[model samples]
Target chain A: MDLVKVQLTNSEFLSTGIEKLDNLLEGGILKGFTTLILGSPGSSIEILSKQLAVKGKVLYVTTDETEQEVMDAITRFGWKPEHIEFTDIATKYSKSVLSREKKRVSIYEQRSKLKLKELIEIGSSGVMPAVKAQEDFLAIFSNSAKTTSPEKIILNSLDFFLSMYSQEEVLRTLHAAKVANIERAGVLFIIMTKGIHGEVFERKMEGMADCVLELNVIQKGSTFERFLAVKKMRNYAKKIGIARYAIDSDGFVLEMIERIM
Target chain B: MTNSESYVYNQNRIGLNENENAKSSCPCITGIDELDQKLGGGLPSGNTVLLVGSSGSGKTTLSMQFLTNGAKIGERGVFFTITEPLFKLTKNLEKFDFYDKKMIESGMVNLIDLRIISERLGLDAEKYTVEDASALLEILKDIADELDVKRLIIDSITALCYRLQTKEMIRDFIFKLGSSLASMNCTTILTSEVPPNEVKYSQYGIEEFIADGIIFLGDVDRKGDLIRTLQVIKMRGTNHSRTKSAMSISSKNGIELTPLLKSRV
Candidate 1:
């Protein structure tokens, strides 16, 4: 395994699997630091998170996609899903708010399908206070940390909480998450969509995140190009430019298209 | 308070004459004339009506319109809201022009939040235990009787089914609730979410059978886009139109129905 390793104070940095991407972040992302992935709908952050999951234990907290869908994607990417853990908040919200679509009714079935060590479902009982839901999510994460001590935790999106709660509530929850990340020395990936929240809300998150990775899609002629740019990384080797990437059957492949020079 | 005193209170609160209540045989006006026409004249009094639709299909709006219309005519209403909080419901209703501040102040429209009831019963506010459902029924009956409510609306009855954990429990609750509302001579509307691709009108497949009337709201696929439509699937006491009428809803006018859409050959 050509996994690059870097030493950060009080923690170990593991390779992000992509050599060019790892080189940009000075070998890899810090083990205990929180990384924010900012992008729009079409960005391939899901694939990127999956790529990162391959290195070690992953705890994927999904608020957008179903647990099965995430597992299917992992398998498609040539990784065994049994290696990862999932915390599904989206299915519960969908069951409470939306109609009982065929997919939502299958949440129980999906729960049965997961291995005992791989699933934690919050809000399964019913509609809950945003604070309570956040607490439940954090509680499971902490418990999993005790048992498995996941090396990486992925929060699929913050958009769901934005819909269910106030800016202050979500920010407070993120603050707690950041503290946990530091204490556990585990990397946390917070996925978010840009241009959805107000300027102040976005600025607050950008300031709190230890590292911010922005993904943008540019339309040129009849084609669209996707690029990942490292905007900020506190106390780490930071790259100032972008790396173009493409998705194939294997997974996300960083292309040698052009440097953001 | 005595029955006469309660009547005076409700009448003075709505600022309506006593003669309106004397015409008790007249159907409850839903505030939308097209809908009233489809229903042969709104919903039948002393009967329970079911409003079934998918989320975002305006079930809440339609129920609100019904209660507000009853309130306008000095008919007291009790709105038992389950999912949405009272403040959020009030705030959203404020966007509509027909929202009666005077009626609310005078207690012509009473909003009883049922969230606390679930909490008090030591049950999850989203899921329903049999005991909790029984408690809820008693609470509802007490409110309807105490308020002398002529109109009652339980927003999203499907939530109860979602929590109750069994088809028998849901059916039992519906039966008990329907009979209690009828005994009080209350014209009621219970809203529920339509299960996906289900042949039945409601998610549990028993609400339509138990209800006195069923107003099914849905989106119709036209050429490229979807249009809102309302159909009166069943009205037990009245002869209603079976046609699906084109419908539209806005904050200003609430729900408006056009002429029935002609079925193309």
Candidate 2:
């Protein structure tokens, strides 16, 4: 049986900025689709996401990396960082922790000198050391996503939020963002690590997304090879294939795509 | 007598034997003539006065008027704000003719935010510890020394004390701050917030005790209308009238105080 090619205009799709990937994705990611990218350590998922951001107005919600670090990585790869607006959760989280630690130290040093009444007051006031309210990063990300009408949205890694917040909270925010992106006809990319979250949760995440891609690094006697698997493409099963890829000086280079039967 | 007549009578009575008292005690004249007369001349120099009032009772306005008036007399004043943002405070001040932007720019009046100072000093605690309070006191002293400030106002000390959880910390902070600023000869006014109609002059119930003076600001219901009133409950180093006065705030007259006439209402 011969496969017939269907053409989609540029307006109907959001390009991943790689010609080969766009061809493999059938003109690129469909507009309004939420794409989930699952990768393990050494899989170069970061570079892939940054490459996806090269073409559009991007709101990059970075949880595991600071804005400066992300910009430095993007710059080092010769990508333009000017078009990206970052909601940097990593720096905020780190600063909150450091500030809490300093406050704890100061409280400890003054504890012995405080009178019993003073200690009682401190206890009653609920201003004890390290008791500051934690910031709701999910809400922050949701707010930024709602306020800005970006063409592309990228959340680099779900593990940070999953460890900090409940699954329900994370899912609610993700669903809201997905609906907003759908309304704006924009693309949303959520990055998560493979195998860390349970298979059930992983499947739930994949079910939420319109498309799912996975990057795997395999070792054969100390020589590791990287492969990008198009595991799920809702309503477009023909695009399900695997591509062996390398990160060369020019960025993500797709060596070959093996079509799935 | 009519209210206007009493206002004129009080205005005429100002500056009578007040200059002698002011010269002897080195008073920090508030420049509000009636309030200055009520304070014999003005607030005693280097004294920490607790200006206690509820919301919208003119505590902030009175403090700003005091500082701006001091600026007019060639005295530099600094307002360390903890509750309101500096921009919002200045925006509100812009409506008053006494609020001169030139005074702020020329270093005659300084408006500083305590939160910004804490951030700059790397003290990021939401609730300040005793050590943090001590460090804050030092910062205040350093600011006083650096600016050569003659008058200092900490708008709403309640907010600052809220961050300071313990009574001992608040006491130590205020006592030390008072002494340090007093040593520098900086007349300080620390605003304290309390519930309306509450007899207490401060939120913590301890600031009024430590403070050298207490100026209580309140509102009285006069025939279904609320009238702001100011009363000097305690003023050291000079004789002052303890009678409550009717106060009004306006753009033309920043703060006008008239003796509360018994027969007017």
Q: Listing candidates in order, what is each one's chain A TM-score?
A: 0.75, 0.90
Query: Superposing all C-alpha atoms, what RMSD in Å does each candidate have to the true structure?
Result: 16.7, 14.8
Looking at model 1, the pairs that clash are B128-B163
Kindly list the per-residue Cα lDDT of model 1 for residues A130-198, writing each as its tens digit: 422323443443444456567788887788777767889788878888887888888888888888898
Worst 10 residues of 1 chain B by lDDT: B13-22
Candidate 2 wrongly placed segments (more than 4 Å): A1-96, A99-261, B1-24, B263-265
**Which DockQ-derived CAPRI band holds candidate 2?**
incorrect
CA lDDT, every prediction? 0.73, 0.83
User: Could you give candidate 2's per-residue lDDT for residues A1-261 as a string of tens digits?
Assistant: 011124434477877777778767767889899999999889989888888778878999998889998888888889875478989999989988777566433433323434322432332232224434678888888888777789899999788999888888889889998999899999999999999888998999999999999999999798999999899998999999999999987689988989894
Which parts of model 1 are misplaced by more than 4 Å?
Answer: A1-261, B1-24, B195-199, B263-265
Of the candidates shown, which would achieve the greatest TM-score relative to the real structure?
Answer: 2
Compute the lDDT of residue B181 as modeled in candidate 2: 92
lDDT of 2 by residue, B110-229 (tens): 888766666434464468867677767766787677679999999879999898999999899999999999988899999999999888899988999999999998888778888888
